[model samples]
Target: MTDLAGRTALVTGGGSGLGAAIATALHAAGADVVVVGRDEAKLDAVAARLGRRARALTCDVSDPASVEELRSRLADTAVSILVNNAGVPGPVAALTDISVEDWDAVFDVNVRGTFLLCRAFLPAMIERGAGDVINVASVSGKRPLAHRTPYCASKMAVIGLTSTLAFEVGPAGVSVNTLSPGPVEGPRMARNFRLEAERSGGSVAEAEAAFVSRAALGRMVTEEEVGRAVVAMLDMPGLCGADVDLSAGMIA
Candidate 1:
């Protein structure tokens, strides 16, 4: 079991979905968690549910100024665990149909945002000689997803970043790894499926079914499953510079 008592963990995009679940799991493991996201109310709601062990902080991860503000606010706080979960799905369209603005938006949140948070918090972890950084990527990064060009590209960048950071920081006793989830069952997944259905001239149910068919389990992965995987990653001391696939056989 991972004993995180007396540790402070910061989870970006912790307002809902996988981020919220991760924050809850980390708190349950005895870590003081700070949930950061753009939706203040959502963050507050999650924090309230987690009791005093959790607190909410509003932040737009894609914006440098906003990330800097977060850095300034937590200047005195030592974050022993950092989870970069904030990300955008990007526009579901072919590469030819995707505009530069849309592609950049996805990269800003999924790549630049993770980079900024690591830049802000990693030095302290290195100085302390102990810390964990988990970057939430997706199976889409490993395999091509037909219409999600920007999101796929951004996640690939995340995986690359995770590997590079792990090598650079491992000597300081800081472990950096990427957790790539498969087709998760959630509102976000539903939304993406709907968009795919429309683009393919099919029904949402059909699209969802097709997605499940690709998975060996013939079903979507749960948010709680993803949460448990995060906890497991934190508990494993030997894992570093690795791409942990929580994709239910989808990526394999």
Candidate 2:
């Protein structure tokens, strides 16, 4: 658990769900963790669970100004690990049904957010010649997800960024890897099921079943698995420009 001792990690959207889980795992691995999100209360709650070696800050990853402010705030802290976990699921509807605003909103957060955070932090990591950047993309990025064009496209963008950024920063001893998780069980997914059911005139159970069936394991991955995977990837010093799928065999 002390594998990351003496290191500092900054996790965006660390207030809840996968982000919170990742923060906890990093903290457990002995990294000083800074959890950032739009919700102060949720961030505080996650910080509380982390006890020592954890603190909370609020920032909108999609906002350049906010990210710049965050960079200013962490000027004294050398963030060795950056987890771009903040993302929106976007509207669960066909591309034609999804509005321009909805589509842009997804890209702004899922794509632009990752870019802003990297722009704000990568320089220091390159200067120091040591760091890890994990972008939480989704399996939807590689596969076509029905009725979720915006989400799929945005994630693909993140995936592309991870690989290209790794190639750019690897010489500086920085590792940039994409963590693409499959359908995860949580409120977000529950809401997706609700919307999908409403769209297809099917029960929520049916909607869930259809999605889960795509995974070879016939089950969704858990947030903890993802958190641990982040730790695992970080532990591997040679891992760079890699898309590690923790999706329970959702290869189809």
Candidate 3:
């Protein structure tokens, strides 16, 4: 068991779902956690539940100004763990029909935000010779989805980013890894399923079931499952730069 006692961690998108799960895990491991998200109320609620060790901050990862503000605020704090989990589902459009604006917007959060956050935090970690960065990518990063051109492209870019950063920072005691989860059962997934159901003339239940059936595990991933994996990564020593696929073997 790895102990993060007295360590500081910053988790983006920690207002709910997988982000909350990772924050909780970090707290349980004895780390002081800072949760950031666009929703102040949601961030507050999660931080409150996470106890005194957790603090909440608000920022939109897609906005350069917001990210700059976040960097300023966190400058004085020694953050050793960085989880880049904030992301958009991306505007659904066929590759041939996608707009430049739509593609840029998605890339802004998934790629540019990841880039900025890493750039902002790495100096401190490098100086101290310790840190871990987890980028919450998706199976779509490795495999293409029918109508998710922007998201897929952005995530694929993330895979490359994770690998390259891991190599560059590994010698300095900073570990960077990417996690690509299959479909997870959460409010986000439910909303997506609902939309697909309506658009495809299928019931919501049917749509959800179809998603599960296509997965190698024949089930939707649980928040707890993802939480534990992140926790494990935090615990592992000398581990740097790996694409951990949590797709339940569904990559095929």
Over 80-139, each residue of candidate 2 has an lDDT whose tens digit, in order, gives 999999999999887888899999999999999999999999999999989999999999
TM-score of every model? 0.98, 0.98, 0.94
Q: Total backbone clashes of model 1?
A: 0
Which of 1 and 3 is ahead in TM-score?
A: 1
Q: Which tens-of-lDDT digit does each residue in 164-192 have in candidate 3? A: 99989999989999988888878888887
Weakest ten-residue segment in model 3 by summed lDDT: 89-98
What does candidate 1's lDDT look like per residue over 1-252, in tens digits? Answer: 577899999999999999999998899889999999999999999999999878999999988899999999998899999999999898998899999999899999999999999998999999999999999999999896898989998999999999999999999999999999998999999999899999999999999998888888888899998988998999899999999998878977
Give the clash count for each candidate: 0, 0, 0
Q: All models: lDDT? A: 0.93, 0.94, 0.87
Q: Which should have the higher lDDT, number 1 or number 2?
A: 2
